[model samples]
Target: MKKFIGISILALLVGFFSANAQDTAKNVTTKVKESAVKVGDKTAELASKGKNAITDKVYKDKEGPNGETIYIDKHSKYYWIDKKGHKVPISKNKLISKQ
Candidate 1:
């Protein structure tokens, strides 16, 4: 009778450990899925911001008041032209120095 009781207790202990391991695996899988979703959202937001920055640069170069033209040079710098058709140099140092 003592031997039978010992075997039953061993079996119960084994079953309890197996159940606990399965619960831990399930929690880890849930956490990984949530982290993957958050990373995907951040990637999409960064791509959208990059596209908007390009569009804004193009719009600034093309749109202006009547008889005035805005130009962006190869160095990604900006300048303006007036109605008098004169070549005016805008000071890049002054523009960049401003906070």
Candidate 2:
């Protein structure tokens, strides 16, 4: 029983060392995509030498049906884009201004 416990601890240490030595570069990448409006600047700058998503344009923050926050450009008509870039439409009747 003692031998089994020692062997288990040794195995755990070896596994931890091997995992630590594994290349982390491949595992690190930005999972976010940038649309016309960019929100992933900081991650991109860290990823590359030096870069960022900067814009002089302005956007408005809006809410989806389920209460997800979304950003909208000035030209965006009754629709807002979700994080996945999918459109979540808002009806005129359901809008606070319209109501």
**Cα lDDT tens digits for candidate 2, 1-99:** 999999999999999888876645334432233332365544443333211112112123434455543333355545544444454666644543211
Clashing pairs in 2: none
- TM-score of model 2 (CA atoms): 0.28
Please give, for residues 67-98, the per-residue lDDT of candidate 1 as tens digits.
Answer: 23344555666555432333244544433321
The pairs that clash in candidate 1 are: none
lDDT score of residue 3 within candidate 2: 100
Give the TM-scores of the predictions, in the order they appear: 0.54, 0.28
Worst 10 residues of 2 by lDDT: 49-58
Q: Model 1 scores what on Cα lDDT?
A: 0.57
